[model samples]
Target: MTASDDEKKMLRASLQSMTGALESVKMSKANTKPRVCLYEVIATARDGLLRRTKLSSDIRKEEGHRRDLNHAVKDANVNVKCKQQLAFNNQDPAQQDAIANDVENAKEEVITKQLEADAQKERVSSLYLERDDFNNALSRMLDATSIVMPFVNLGEIDDDMLQVGITAQSTFMQFCEDWERR
Candidate 1:
């Protein structure tokens, strides 16, 4: 299901505030000339923020897995005593035993929990890898925009200018994109 009405209202309010702030920035006068499209700047900034958030989320997931595994081990260790006690509850060996069965169940539970934690850890690592790639791509884009924007301020908007001369920003973006693919 979707979010509740209250949640939607809160989100809308937040969005409105963000829009107002961005509009203010757009209207502000600047000493430095903006050479690239404003959209490019906004997009690059947003991408940077997204990459950072993804990287942080990956780290949190990895830490969460570690905590989960620790909890599972603790629970199993405590359950060990219970299982042993339950297994030998009967007064005689003549009766069918259950302590062994309880212990086996505990073992299975520990194994299951550990496996789940391991899966989460692997997922976290995968996210981190993607995060790194995105970060590199954003950095390259930022560099390109920095160089292009200044040229644009100088009334040089043609693609031919970029072709005639190699800017560090453009080169860096190309290098980053290539590396990210690998």
Candidate 2:
């Protein structure tokens, strides 16, 4: 019914969309066929990465807007408090009523803005979590592909080769985790 309510609905929709996208990427990783070409795998990973990047950008933008709205809410609260105090100390009944009305209106506006900002924050947080999930899935796919594709291409389907691939994948994943920490 209200603008804030509409904004909350939009935020929920965005979060659902992002979650679905991440789930799709996870499905793709799970269903990857050994016979699939390396190029296609790379392209799929690239697409996931690009989507994650876009989500990150959107989260940043929403964070900025949320911060601005929070500031506005604070200003509005201050204005309402000032008006209320003035009304309380006023001598004229008419002037006091007018100031009280202004304070009430400001309070309503602050509540609406606060609700919008909170919804934006929720959306941003959801996007960040989804982006992280997508990134992790993509990294695992790339790491596995890097280690396994070589042996697969060489037609070396043996226990020794599988062991080597697993070792390489572990080492590569560890290196990546360390690099991220730095």
Candidate 3:
């Protein structure tokens, strides 16, 4: 189905918003230096990663919903066709009329299912695009953070510092794995 003007406008607006957010993240990462607090930088990057993860999850859900809708539409179409065939073959006039009505209803159901599937497909596509944009931005931020984090002076080494470093390393590894999975 063709997108309406309003739908197009909404899509454009969403894309623009994602683009702006990604640009902001990129700018922040680019401006990062060794003098910047590693914790704060990591926190910001972690937030972006979380957002990207959430968007990816949403995209997955939308894809599943779209698949279900497509199956429903296919089933509805098959039912309509089967009913139409039955209606034509029936010898009794009354039975034929009843079957014809059933076929009409099935046709209407197919139309409804098709519309729903189309809308769901559109949503899934939009979500995938948004997720990709966020993922790219997050990946850049993570890369920048990794490069700058090691150089940042965190004062004299202590047990607390060691623990923090270990935690950060673990989290970063998990983030990398998650990105790779996607």
Candidate whose lDDT is highest: 3
Clashes of 3: 0
TM-scores of all candidate predictions against the true structure: 0.54, 0.61, 0.61
Candidate with more favorable, higher TM-score: 1 or 3: 3
Q: How far off is residue 29 in model 1, in Å?
A: 18
TM-score of 2: 0.61
Model 2, position 139, has a per-residue lDDT of: 76
What are the lDDT scores of the predictions, listed in order?
0.65, 0.71, 0.72
* Backbone atom clashes (below 3 Å) for every candidate: 3, 0, 0
| Backbone steric clashes in candidate 1, count | 3
Q: In candidate 3, which residue pairs clash? A: none
What's the lDDT for candidate 3? 0.72
Name the TM-score of candidate 3: 0.61
The residue-by-residue lDDT of candidate 2 on 1-182, one tens digit each, is 55698899999999999999999887565434333444455566566567667778888888898899889889989988898889889999889888988989999998998998898889888777766765676677778667767766665435554554455445544544664464
Give the better candidate number (1 or 2) by TM-score. Answer: 2
Residue 17 deviation, candidate 2, in Å? 58
